[model samples]
Target: MKLAWLRSLESAHQDCVWACTWVPATDRSGGLLLTGSLDETVKLWNPEDLSVVRTNTGHCLGVVSVAAHPSGRIAASASMDSFIRVFDVESNNTIATLEAPPSEVWQMQFDPRGTTLAVAGGSSASVKLWDTAEWKLVSTLSIPRPEGAKPSDKGSSKKFVLSVAWSPSGRQLACGSMDGSISVFDVQRAKFLHHLEGHTMPVRSLAYSPLDPRVLVSGSDDECIHMYDAEGKTLFSSMSGHSSWVLSVDVSPDGAAIASGSSDRTVRLWDPKMRAAVQTMTNHTDQVWGVKFEAVGGGARGSLLASVSDDKSISLYNYS
Candidate 1:
C-alpha cells in the first residue's frame, strides 16, 4: 500500500480541525468532504480540487466529531458543550438539535442503514442510540463499572468514552474510553457483550474493517495501534511507531492497510499483514487529530484519505 500526497489546504480553518468524514455521492454532486474544527465550525470541501464548498457556523465550543448520513442528505456535528446539530448537506438548514443532559457527547456515527445514530456518552459511561426518523432517544447501552468498583471511584470516572464505531453488519457496536478499555455491544439485544483490554491510556479513535465484522482497530494515547477480534475478545496484535499519542486511525476501503494520525505530527500508513508502518508522511508541524478514508468509491475520485491537524491545515492523499 502507498499514499501519494494530493494537496494541502493551509489554514483551512481559523483553529484546529479535529474531526472529518466523507459525504457520499448524490445526484446533485459527487462525494464531498466534511470537517469540524476547534473554531466552532464545520466546513464542506470538494475532493477533486480540494476547494472549500461551504462553512457551517454556530457551534459553541470546539466541535469534537462529525458524521454523515449514508444518503448524503444529512450530517451531524457535535461539540464539547454536549450539543449535536443535525443539518441538511445541500441547503445547510437545521434539521434537529439533540442533547442528553449531564451526559457529554464525543465521537458519533450513523448506522450503516441510517436508521439510528450512535453517540459516545462521555461521562454517562454509555453509548446513546437515537432514532433518526423521530430524533428521540431510543436506548442507552451502559458500560457496567468493574467488580468492586464504587460509583464515585476513579475507575468509574476514567470510563469517559471518547470514540465509537459500528460493525459492517450493524449488529455490533464498540466504544473506546479514556481508561483504555473497548466495550463491544450487541445492537440487537442492547446488551454489553464484553471488554477488550490492552492499552492503559485513553483510546481516542476506533474503526472496524469494512470487509470483516470481527476485526477492530484502535488508536490510543499510549502511542500504539491495536488490532482485536471483536467477537472473540482478543487483542491479537499491537503496533507502535509514533513518538507520541496516536490520535486517529482508519482502515482502507479494501482492508489492505491502516492509516493513522498522531500527536507527533505525522501520518503513517501501515500494512496490517506485515504488522509495520510502510510509509510515513511528516508534513504537518502540529499534532494531527483526525484521519479518515472515504466510505464509498466511484465518480471522479477513486480512493481518498484526508487528515486534519492542530496546525490549522487539511491534507488530502491518494491511497492505493
Candidate 2:
C-alpha cells in the first residue's frame, strides 16, 4: 500500500482551507469534493479536474468545517462565528441556517444513515444533534465533568469540544476535547459512556473505521495518532512520528490504513497492525488542516486521498 501523487491545486482557496470531504456519488451526479476555507467561502470542486463546480459564500469569521450528507444532495458548513449553513449541493439554495448561542460550533458531521447532524459544541463541552427532517436541534450530548470538580474551576472550562465522529453503526458517537480526552456516547440513550485518554493536548480530529465498529482513530496537538477501542474504552495503539500537531485524520474505505495531516506540513499513512507510520508525503509547505479519503472507491482510481492546507492549496493522491 502506497500513495502516488496525482495532482495538486495551488491557491485552491484564498486563505486556509480548513476542511475537505468527498461527497458520495448520486444517481444524478458523480462524486464531488467539498471544501471549507478561512476566506469565508465553501467551495465544491470537480474531483476529476479540480475545477470549481461552485463557490458558496455567506459565512463569516472563516468557514472551518464542512460535511456532506449520505445522500449527496445536501451539505452543511460551519464558520468561526458558530453559524451553520445547510444547503442543496446542486442549486446552492439555502436549506437552513442553524445556531446554538453560548455554544460555538467547531466540527460537524452527518450520520451514515442520514438521519441527524452531529456537531462539536465548542466551549459548551457537548455534542449537539439535529434532526435532519425537521432541521431542529434535538439533543445535546454533554461530557460528564470529573467528580468534585466545580463549574468554577478554571480547568473545567478547557474541556472545549473540538472534534466529533460517528461510529459505523451510528448508534454511538465520539467527541474529542481541547483538554486531551475523548468522550464516547450512546446516541439513542443520549448518555456519555467513557473517555479514551492518552494525548495531553487538544485532539483536533477523530475517525471511525468503516469496517470495524469498535475502532476509533484520533489525531492531537501532542503530535501523535492514537487508535482506541470505542466499545471497550481502551487505547489500542499510539503512533508518533509527526513533528507538530496532528490536525486531521481519516480511515480509508477498507479500514486497512489511517491517514493524517499535521502542523508539520506532512500527510502520513499508518498501518494499524504494526502501530507505525508506513509512509509520509511532505507535499504541503504549511500546516495541513485536513486529509480525507474518498468514501467509496474502486476501478482504476483505486482510492483517492485529499489534503488541504494552511498554504491555501489542495493536494490529491492515489492510494493503492
RMSD of 1: 1.7
Worst lDDT run of 10 residues, candidate 2, spans 146-155
RMSD values for the candidates in order, in angstroms, are 1.7, 1.5
TM-score of 2: 0.97
Runs in model 2 deviating more than 4 A are 146-155
Q: List the residue pairs that clash in candidate 1.
A: none
Tens digits of lDDT, candidate 1, 74-182: 9999998679999999988999999765448889999999999999999888899999999999999998765455667654669898899999989999999988889
The Cα error of candidate 2 at residue 144, in Å, is 0.9
C-alpha lDDT of residue 32 in model 1: 92
Backbone clash total, candidate 2: 0
Per-residue C-alpha lDDT of model 2 across residues 1-320, encoded as one tens digit per residue: 78998999999999999999988889999999999999999999998889999999878779989999999999999998768999999999999999866438889999999999999998888899999998999999988764444777544756899999999999999999998889999999998888888888999999999999999999999999999999998997999999999999999988999999999999999998998999999989999999999955556767899999999999999998
Best by TM-score: 2
